[model samples]
Target: MNRSTNFVLAQILFVILLLTACSTEKTASDSEPKKKEPKKETVEKAPTEPEEMVKQGAGEHYEKVKDLEGDDLDKEIKELTKDFPKDMKSEDAYNRIIAAFAADHQLAFQELEDFDITFEEVEAYEKYSEEDGEEKKEGPLNVVILLDASGSMAGKVSGTDKMTAAKEALKKFAGGLPKDANVLLRVYGHKGSNDDKDKKLSCESTEVMYPLGAYDAGAFQQSLSKFKPTGWTPLAASIEAAEKDLQGKEGNNVVYIVSDGIETCDGNPIEAAKKLHKSNIQAKVNIIGFDVDNEGQQQLKAVAEAGGGEFQSVSSQKELFDEVESNWSKAMHDARINWSLSMDSSSVNWSSSGKGHSMRKVYSKMLDSISDEFELLRSVKMELYNQKKMTNEELDKLDKLIFSRYEKLREYSTNKHDAKQAALDKETDRVLKLIDENAENARVE
Candidate 1:
């Protein structure tokens, strides 16, 4: 019974071992990694073109602008820019056009204020009197007359040669001058004939016939008689020479230039005047255009302004005398006032005011309009540049127009300011004169 049991157990053990070997072989087969197949090379098709860039309505507006001219162009530009987009490229083109239009339309107008009639403070008068006294008492009364003897002066006006009328006017002016004032007569274009052959010699003819000092009336008259109307105008050269003549002369220098036309010797009289004004002499220039035409008047006006002086146009001897007398009377009054104010401390103080507040407002509005237009143009120009519609050359033209408009505004402002100041000064002078006359009467009493 023991042997049979042991045999059965051995058989069962062998069956268990065969089952374990089969399970091990199956696990090994499941755990091993499988080999992957190689991937096929990808063939990328060529990229399709991007969608066409969409353009704004710049081309359409540009075409519209090109077809317009004058008022129509201006009106259209104004209408287009009225509601223009801030960031739109086509807006730039509109701005450029509008800027040019505004520049062309810029008009200069002056607003003059009424003179102030009340004094601010006694101290102000005292200060002004002190400065006036310093100028009045220290310098010698020096007067230099620049007489033009250009060929044009020989032409007849009102049945008399302009040169003869000019000389007669000068003689009267010289005679009326205060005895204390030192006189100098400088004549230009007095040498050489008006012929083209004599051009070189005429251009070089600028001489101080009478030096800056006391002169005999007869001698001065003779000097005037010596020269006849001949040669080209050397106006600029004559003024430059006058600067040297006045050098080292003290007190109250006045320069009077009598000319028939603009500079014919290619010299810049305006520049010469500017140099003389800025010099240490501190002279005041007064220009008399002796029957000068419109073009000549314009140029002479610029010279007078630049020289800090006044310009007067005269066609006859009577007109010349009137202007000269008026100027002299004013000068004499100013001198007397300065002297009196300096001597007397008991005089009452006076002040000045303006009368053009309403006009000034109008002027301000106009200036604001210009400024607004300029800013709009500037913005538009930049926009157009970004849009590539404006070339550099075209932008430069716009820039010049903008600059010109700005300059015009500035000049207008300056002129208005000067006019207002002059009016106030004249009123002040009137008041001072009254006070002076009253003081004299009191002293006489």
Candidate 2:
């Protein structure tokens, strides 16, 4: 119990207490439940054979059959598909083939569009003038009035003759026109009498009384007085003749046809109007049914639609005059804006010299080839299916061939497009700059 004995005893007791506390903590930890580690999720990557790769593989196979035709083509197809799995269902196999062909076709079209194939041709504007050689006002409004001087026009409408009403309306319309507008007066079916025997003469009676020129009120009135409604209606022939009358003239040309009846001379007015619409003259024809019946109005409406113009039904003189003036004003305004834009110096002129022209030609030819091939393949597939001569395996083989051809063409076009895009973009920028300058000038004017 001395000082040395007491120190040794205290050390032993402290060591025991530390050991007991460690053992108790370990027991408590072992009694509790252990937390389970979260299992790592394994995501399966999507099937690695991309459409592009499939197309590439198909393309290699396509080279073998591209040159084959007739029996040779059939023989090649049979040989290529001979190893296909026999257990595959026919419908399933057909669907797969169709899907592959569709993908390839889409890709081919996309690649083709990548090439800047648009040719920037410069527009040649012909300087129009009066017969006396004085240049017509340099605006874009050209109006042609087609008056129906047939027998029906002489018929009474709203306490006056249809012809009189039309004349008054036209005169009012002329007065409202802008000074810069060029106007023409064409009359049809005013030759022979409206008898069945004079049908031939009436049909061929189309004439341009007032040729395209500056609006001359006195001259147009004089021309109007000369025509009387004695002959049969010859609507179609007049339209056809009008196309020639405005042949070389440019700008927004509008034709206003005043009629009371349908064609009686076996001429197709709708067809004629369609031709005029699609012609290089860029004319729109508006039809005014002057006291016409339902049947006549319907036919006239069709003609107007074909000519890319509107149809107006007028029961009185006021409606006729109002419609004509409104349409003319609106059309002239639109034409002025359009003409200004077209004449802008920044617009692309496809006639320009350089690699652009050559590239356009090459791209055009490539497009034509691809189109022809596509059509040929489609026709062949359709023919075989219709004849029931093509088995599912054979169709699958053909699809592969199509896919390969498309893939090859796409690759070729893509390469060409990549090579030319930079140069094309530079040229485009130059054109755009010019357009911007022109637009500013137009706005200022």
Candidate 3:
């Protein structure tokens, strides 16, 4: 045991370490706090583990692999994986496996994006528009009032003339209509006198006093004043005029006629009223016969019945006022009902278009894509391992990188699903609330 003997033994130990450097396995004994490391082993640096190499080059490695695209990505991945590294290079292994299926990973990320969810498809929601002082009226219902300004309407009811009482009641009724509704006022038989000579002129008299539009108190009152009771009762002619006014107009339309008698001037009121009701407009024609005789009442009622509307006979001014008020109440009720029906129909299909449960489907697809990516990377790793291109250590490192990508993307998919679901709920509730507010304001008492 001299100096020569010590030098020869050290040289043999160095050769043993070099041979074992290619295959080193880590034992748990050195990792456990209670276990003491043996001093007989050499002070040489142990081979870096495959998992450690992956953890060390995590952030920058993932970014490099993610940015690679097109022919450049294809060339780099093919060249790196053509023959796996002879040396332990974790970066090359990550790039080769991860970059190969860039398009797949891109698609998975794209699915994670939240799509737009809205109530635009719902009819009521699509048509709803409200602003203070400025009208946004595309109303689904139009009310056309046909005033009979013939000589008989000049007759008396409660000492106040029929024409005066009717006009006053109508002006108040129109003023109280829901802001979203359109009002049209038409007058007939106001041009000629009640004489037989003016009969032809009176029968042909029909004019729109107030054009169809949003209810305006001032304009509507002015329109009502434009006509007076002066000519023969052209009841059939007035209703026909209303049908022409709403000829091509869309939505639920109605014609209300205030008359004191049946058709005069030899016109067929029943046939004319029937034709208006059955036309494309499908307008209901209600009649309010004020201060009329038994014969006039019976004939007026028949005309209304043929027109698919009710007839109300009134001898006093109070009856006229009450009837118009009833019409207003019914209009508000119908508006509420229409809105509720639209909401119910929309909710039935909300899962697909409104994203109620569709978010879960999107998330499920994202997870499947992540699994596909995980398996794809493993396939590349296995191909390298199957060929024995790289050492077992480098291939193990590539497996760690693939697992890392799977977990990161899985977390991302979950977060995106949660965020998207929240957004869908928020937007849906906002639209529903807006619908409620509009319906509530529709009551114009």
Candidate 4:
């Protein structure tokens, strides 16, 4: 052990001791509790698009005729007589002819909801002359004329401006209407408020330029001239409004909708129509699509179905005029639509198809029963409301009864029985007859 070696060893020992002390301090610090980190939260996202719905439809039918004399005949005739106008055109005559045919054949006509048409305009004009002043076989009608007024229609109609053209056609049609008939004029997408430029886009929205009534053709046309095409099309709102206008009015209410485009606003025209049908609004909707796209055609067709009427697609002004003329003709001649289902070349025979005759009859009966129940409930409610002396308690009771009945009705409808709604079916036929009779009697003078 020399003195130099011992000094080196001593230096090495001091270095080791210092390192051990630092390690001890680090271990002690690590033993203390530390703050925990938060877990990242996740949020769910909603679907960015709506599911697509199928656009399929099944055809419908009507028994156009009935000669069941006495009360039965009266009941059947009454069912067929509602919602008809006093004056109709040749085009409106088809419904009547079909009813007569149905009666003769003892069979019903199968029809698509959108295929209602008038056969021909009756030209005699003097058939409705008062003979001995006997209550001239009464024919009364209420018609709604919907005219298109989008910017596209700004030009002349049949050599006149679009608005003018409509007025002219309407005037001509009215010339053939009975003096006692009612007429309502509706113009859509016609004008825009000066204050807003955006509103101009939807200028073709609907407006009731005239309520249902007998009036001068010249005056009517002049009145219609005030409207100009400068906005967007609000077809749905227009239809809904028209339905509201005809809400509780008497006689047959016909909605003759004329348009160039589909609905462009926040409205469901088809749904509105269905509302009209389900509620038995006493209004039948007939649609004329004037130069539209496929989508527009579909929407219009749906609207017609909801209205329990038909849709007519027009490609040109001439076609539009022709359709109007034909409708007038049908109204006068009283043509009936004896709808029959010829076996579609691509499908099986109608009789042998999935639904048999007995099943159909059963379904029809069920529907009739349901309709009766609803009518009873509705009458009860209306009566209660009419009683001005009804107390709050009574009102509450009525409301409960209505709700309960409706709930039951919904349940039954969901059960899938192909029931015939008697009131609805009867009302549909009545409307057609009244319109035809009116057409036969309508006079320009």
Candidate number achieving the greatest TM-score relative to the actual structure? 1
Sort by TM-score, top down from the best: 1, 2, 3, 4
For candidate 1, write residues 1-445 as lDDT tens digits.
Answer: 6999999999999999999999999999999999998885332221121111001112224445544556675566556555433333332433435433333222323213332334433333455455643432355468889999988889888788888888887888778776766789999998997788998899899998777777578888888887888889999999899899988864467788889899988999999998888888767777989898889999998988777776878888676766666654334323322444432423332113222332344456556645654564565465455555556776666567555545565565556656665665675676566556543422211
TM-scores of the candidates are 0.52, 0.46, 0.45, 0.43
Q: Which one is best on lDDT?
A: 3
lDDT (tens digit, per residue) of candidate 2 on 313-391: 7777666666566554444433542444444543344222333544454566555656555554554454455445567
lDDT of 4 by residue, 24-69 (tens): 9999889878989988533222111111000111111123222133
lDDT of 3 by residue, 310-365 (tens): 67777889978876766433333233324444444354244334244445655777
Candidate 3 residue pairs in backbone clash? none
**Candidate 4, RMSD to the unseen true structure:** 26.4
Answer with 3 or 4, whichever has the higher TM-score. 3
